[model samples]
Target: MTARSGWVKIVGLGPGADSLVTLEAQAVLAEATDVVGYIPYVARVADRPGLTKHASDNRVEIARSQHALSMAAEGKRVAVVSSGDPGVFAMASAVFEALEAGPDAWKDLHIEVIPGITASLAAAARAGAPLGHDFCTINLSDNLKPWSLIEKRLRLAVEADFAMAFYNPRSKSRPEGFARVLDLLRETCEPDRLMIFARAVSAPDETLSVVPLSDATPEMADMRTMVIVGSSLTRRIAGTSHVYTPRFVAE
Candidate 1:
């Protein structure tokens, strides 16, 4: 494709920190003629001459993806922004889904994914490596998937002894689901299993707390929080808030 031809770059803004934004994502933003994403994510991009920002509400991923693709097809350099890594529960998949179902010529457009740090990794770093060992990441929200699947995965992850990171743990519409998750963990794991609630990680108002599974409450987590449930081996330092899981599991 020629330089004047349209292209789409799915960009990750990282977890609430400008410094965490990857150089490649930044370069794409600088060159992009249009930015598209959720309201907050699109707002994260600084305004510049000749750049237009399109923001949409939640649950509109497909529509948003289609809009970006349409603009790209019209020869606009579009950047679709996501808060964390674009591939991790974000816009990259949505954009591809749109492209697949759209006109076949859309597939010929230049598209690239620019990666960035995800909430799980950022939260793990702030909490001293709780994800050091084998772990699985799951989105607790039932918006797109059934709650049964979420519960099933949680049970299996517990049985397999893998540390788990949960995204979209709780929200206003589904406040009760996280409590159910807590109960499920209580049934399947030890009371003292460490649970880390890393809220608004890397931002000015960031708060990180490590508590035992018995003491964890759903209220500690909100839409902005990243909840990490430790494996049996996960532990906190004797007198500090730091938590970690040993890299090697004993035979």
Candidate 2:
């Protein structure tokens, strides 16, 4: 795409750290005429002379994506922003969903995905590789999907012994879902199974706690937290906060 071409760049800002913003994503933001995303995510982009910010509330992904695509079609260089990697439970999928259902001309537009660090990876790094072995990532919020599906996946992940990472584990409106998750784990996993709660990772106020499955509570997590549950092989270094799953699983 040329400098003046109308385009939409879906960019990931990484998890709460300016330093973690990828250089390519930063460059795209610098050239974007309009930046659109959820309220807090859009606020991450600093004010500039020729840039406009469009911030919307949560659960409006499709509408926000359509607005971005429409702006791009109107010759605006739009950046659709997300907190973590755009493809990881973020805005990239929403953009594609809009593109598929909208006008055919939108499919011809120059759309690019600019990836950044996802929260699961950021949290795993802070806790010393709780995701080192086979792993699965799940968005625990049932806003888009049913809680039954989440429960099914949780059970299968436990049965398969995959290290699991959870996003949006608990929120104000529907706090009970995560409690149900804990109950399911109690039925499926051992009491001493390792669980890591990494909150606000890479930010100044970040806190990480490594606990056992028996000790984990629903209240320990919120929208900003990334929770990781280790596989059967995952372990903590004695007397240290570091946790890791062995890469090699014995037959």
Candidate 3:
């Protein structure tokens, strides 16, 4: 497809608040004829004028991707919106899956993925630089994957001594997941390993705190929270709310 022709743009809307969107993402949205995403995610960009909105439930990935592709195939610029960096367990994957299945009509449609700030980055910034060194991110949700598999990754991360960031840490019905993660980490990391909890980062009710590993109880976190567990190299500076890990190795 020519640059002037209609194309599918999978844009990451970032985590919470409109201001968090990148300028390039905003330009894509402003030019698109259609926007598709989860209900809450679509709502974040609802006020944009002259755009057709298609909102779906959190579970309907295939349907959403097909709809966006169909629109793009019909010569309309379409943007598939995903919250918190589309590449990080967001809508971008589904978009490619739908395309890979060869929807037939969308074969020649040009697709572009515009990156945005993920929740982990937003949370890390709010709590200080816990991600300064090599780190790993894992989602604690067991809806799609087995808890055993999640536990295995946690163990690997801990043993590798990489600072860790956890997404979907806790929810109403799954309160034990985060605690279980902590228990697993305790086997490899000290109880005093630095931990940072950031809730609703960049939103109106944003909250951030830095504490030790043993102190990060389930009550201190929720689904909106992103937990950053530091490695042995992480430390706190005087009179600052951030915790940082050294990126350079000592000679």
Supply the TM-score for candidate 1.
0.97
Backbone clash count for every predicted candidate, in the order shown = 0, 0, 0
Looking at model 3, the pairs that clash are none
Worst lDDT run of 10 residues, candidate 1, spans: 1-10
Name the lDDT value of residue 84 in candidate 1.
88
Instruction: List per-prediction Cα lDDT, in the order shown.
Output: 0.94, 0.94, 0.87
| Candidate 3 Cα outliers beyond 4 Å, as residue runs | 1-4, 46-49
Q: Over the stretch 1-251, how does candidate 3's per-residue lDDT look in tens digits?
A: 44338788999998897888999999999998889999988888756677888889987997899888887887889999998899998888898899989657677888999999999999888777889999999989897799999999988888888998988899888989888887887777888899888898888999988888877777888988888889888999878665899888676
| lDDT of candidate 2 over 179-245, digit per residue (tens) | 9999999999999999999999999999999999999999999999999999999999999878999
Clashing pairs in 1: none
Clash pairs, candidate 2, are none
| TM-scores of all predicted structures | 0.97, 0.97, 0.92
Ordering by lDDT: 2, 1, 3
